[model samples]
Target chain A: MAYSNKVLDHYQHPRNVGSLDKDAADVGTGIVGAPECGDVMKLQIKVDESGRIVDAKFKTYGCGSAIASSSLATEWLKGTTVDEAMAIRNTQIVEELSLPPVKIHCSVLAEDAIKAAIADYQSKQERLREAGAPES
Target chain B: MRHVLLRLIDPFETLGLPATMDLDAATLEARYLELSRTAHPDRNAEVESDAQVAMLARAAAINDAFRTLRDPWTRAQALCERLAPGVVAATAKLSPEFLAGAMELAEAVALAERDAAEALAERIRRALAAILADIRAALTHVDARSAARLLNEARYWQKAGADLRQKLRA
Candidate 1:
């Protein structure tokens, strides 16, 4: 099936495509996949000490819809707190991108990516705390 | 649900052995070729349509069974010996830890580009292989419920591998 115009546009000229320094305590990374279509997405965020997202980036490999979903997620995540970013649902992403039913999983993958990144950040924070290091 | 009659005679049973998961691959392949010469669709083209259809179905079933049983993961799953009805529900719940690992690998793949991505992909590939091996080992001693959980975990890794492969292509 042909991708929606919005999907094609994002796929051709994706936004915020890069990685943060993973070793930085302020940066969180999330990755997700949908096995049914074999699509994978990675999302990263740089959060300030107050947990507000300072920057967002993503890379995705799949159909046009998957690329669009990750691009839209990264754009939506910037300037939001980690909590707000976590609450961004796949349904909202799908609605925003006008993704078709079959491609809905692409949006789900994007949502999962956000959660994964946040979780990773939390785990790192926990490790730092366990080590008696000052929190970033 | 549609009823499927298993009309293909059990050659292993006929040969005086129990239905087994541990068939020798080379012997099985040789036997399959021998059976195909007699029962394959191409060999039975002159037969009546209904007979030919039945023979073709039998041959196809044999091939399918052989293929499934030959693979390590699938064969381990088959050893559990539960019939088809429970297979779906039995293999659906993946562990949270496995999911987290998958998420980590996926993120790594996403950040890496071109050659760098390849290294990340290789790492994920190795991780997935290790997980699959663990699943197979677990399947050997676990009940249906636990085996299903392990199978789902394997499925997650398998999907992760597939996803990374797709990213490499992109």
Candidate 2:
């Protein structure tokens, strides 16, 4: 099936396509791959001390739907709390992008990236807690 | 059984390999390419219809075998099938712990919103790696019984990995 207009637009010109400082306490990175489709995606987020996401970025090597989903997710994540960000549903992304049934998995990937980035931030906080330092 | 027998008679024998799982993929692929070049239907345009059909069947089998052996998870499954035919009926059972872990991961993915995709993907990736490592270590054992169970577990993890990967891509 042909891609939705929104998905095509995002695929043609993605947004927030960059990286964050890996060494930074607030930065979280996630990478995932699908062997069946031979697709890979990397997502990153920068968060502030109050668990507020300041920025998001992604790099995905896959089909048009996958790229569009990542691009849309990155754009949606800015200036949101980690908790709020984690609550962003795949359904919303799919609806917004008007993705076809076959491409629903692409939206799911975007949701996965959000959780991975938050988990990374949480792990970092846990490490800081163990080290007796202020948590980011 | 018929498929196996037909495969053996028509294509597997031609590839010069036993029905066992220890076949080398690179050798098989190279041989497949060489054979396809010689007997390919495209090259035999003036050949009889029966000859073309036979070539097509052999070519398809070669491709199937090459693909099956190229992937470690599928290769392991095929090995189990060859070592103990019909064992798949009983071996499809997944351990409760594995099932639970997969369910938890699936739930995490389901709850994850668009913004948290990266964090969820990272967690799932780490979990999948650990599962794969366990399966790989289990496969190294020589015992047939244990190896069968391990192979089954490997298959489980392979499916789980695919699911997680889809979620990350979604």
Candidate 3:
């Protein structure tokens, strides 16, 4: 199936196509895979002191659609609050990328990656708060 | 007709083989040959056009079944689908740790040098063999869920292995 121009564009010149320090307290890392397709994706978000996502990066091993979905996800993640990022749905991605029905799972995987990253970040913060660490 | 339809869809049934992961190559080949002799479309060319068309379809199905049953990976997948319908869809959730490992392997392959890629491919091949053994055991124990999960993991390893091999070739 033919990929949309936007998907092709992101796939060729993916935004933030790398990784962040996963062990950092402020960085949340989400790694996900689609077993059926043998595809894996890693997404990370660095949250600032005010809970705003300051940076996002991703590396995906799959088809162009999967790469495009995560690339677009990182682009959308930056500058959004945690709640705003959580609200980013796969449907919006599908509409934006014009992904075919069969490729819809790629978007779902991207959405899952976003939620997983936020959850990781929140859990890390919770641990720091419990330890009585000074607010950064 | 119902029986024919069932045979057409199920590789084991089509090839008249038991749904076992440890299938014998010679036995499978013999079964294919025996079935092919009767189902070959050429044998139906002297019959009515409608009958010929039906035979052609059956021949195609038998060929498809042979192809699927010949590969251990595809055979196990077919068994999972047969023994536990909808299991593949329902059990699509893989463990996070496994996904992490897969991501790591994918990245490693992406960045490895030729010598490292060759070593990684060898390691992945060994990993695949181990996973296949586990899958076979799972199937033998009637643990369809474990079998399905192992098959899924094997797929990731296979992709990683393929990527490594491709890099080595480059």
The CAPRI-style docking tier of model 2 reads incorrect
- Model 3 clash pairs are none
What are the per-residue Cα lDDT tens digits for candidate 3 across B32-131?
A: 9999999888776789989888888888889888888888888887887787865655677787788988988888888998667667888898999999
Full candidate order by TM-score, most accurate first: 3, 1, 2
What CA root-mean-square deviation does each model show from the true structure?
6.9, 12.7, 3.5
- Encode model 1's per-residue lDDT on B1-170: one tens digit a residue: 11121223333432232344456788777766776677779878999999988998878766765655557566545544333335534455344455546556556655667878667767767866775666555555555456555555566566656766887777
- For candidate 2, the per-residue lDDT at B15 reads 63
lDDT of each candidate versus the true structure: 0.70, 0.68, 0.88
Predictions in order: chain A TM-score:
0.94, 0.95, 0.98
* Clash number for candidate 3: 0
Q: lDDT tens string, model 3, A30-113?
A: 988888678999999999999899999999999999999999999999999999999999999999999999999999999999
Question: Candidate 3 regions off by >4 Å?
Answer: A125-136, B1-8
How many clashes does each candidate structure show, in the order listed? 1, 28, 0
Tell me the TM-score that candidate 3 gets on chain A alone: 0.98
Docking class of 3: medium
* lDDT tens digits by residue: candidate 1, A1-136: 9788888889999999977887788888776655444455678899888989999988775678989999998889999998888789999988888888888878888888899899988888889899999989
Off by over 4 Å in 1: A35-38, A126-135, B1-21, B25-67, B70-170
